[model samples]
Target: MSDIKVISTENAPAAIGPYVQGKIVNGLLFASGQIPLVPATGAMVEGGIAEQARQALSNVKALVEAAGSDLSKVIKTTCFLKDINDFAAFNAVYAEFFNAPAPARSCVGGIDLPKGALCEIEVIAAV
Candidate 1:
């Protein structure tokens, strides 16, 4: 564990569970899944998947950058949706954050996300 370092930031919601926001090890940052809670108030963001995805990804960006990495350095991502039918809408919002050669991804739906959030996102990046 000597090579591991914890990462955190005030820009993202605090971890309400027994986990840190992220950890860097061997040049990689593993960020915990972020629900659509605003860091300032911890209130779940209101709206549908598109709105939720943006907030969740915003949290992810904060976590990733806390470890000195950016979205462009993300190598992979995993997204969870409360409803699978929201895939198209989720993708639309997601494309706004990631671009060409975007990180490898796996998205799933019907996830009973915490705080009843509409979306959640976790990432792995080169730190």
Candidate 2:
């Protein structure tokens, strides 16, 4: 087995605390949860759910690229949202990025998110 490689990128949000942005092992890249916080300032993007979802997914894309994989290679994903009602909006934006043979996904709604953000995303991709 190949040694695990931690992935990071300045284009994506820096992990708020003690954690790598993503890690690769055995031909798979596992990305940590991506919040809507902009990497340049480490602050949440100023917008609604759709915007937040866009930013979060963009961040996840960056991590995937940093891990030597691209969004098209993503096999699975987990999404967290502050409100279930916004699922359609989120899915709309999500569909723009991942279409056709969509990656397996699990999207859940919750009462809160870090920094009061509206969405967060994580992904797993085969390299």
Question: Which residue runs of candidate 1 sit more than 4 Å off their true CA positions?
Answer: none
* Cα lDDT of model 2 by residue, 71-107, tens digit: 9999999999899999999999999789779999999
Q: Residue-wise lDDT of candidate 1 within 1-127, one digit each (tens)?
A: 5588999899999999999999999999999999999999999888888888999999999998889989999999999888999999999999999998989999989879888888889999998
For model 2 the local lDDT of residue 48 reads 94
What overall lDDT goes with each candidate model?
0.92, 0.90
TM-score of predicted structure 2:
0.96
Q: Which stretches of candidate 2 lie over 4 Å from their true place?
A: none
RMSD of 1: 0.9
lDDT for position 28 in model 2? 95
Clashing pairs in 1: none
The TM-scores, one per candidate, come to: 0.97, 0.96
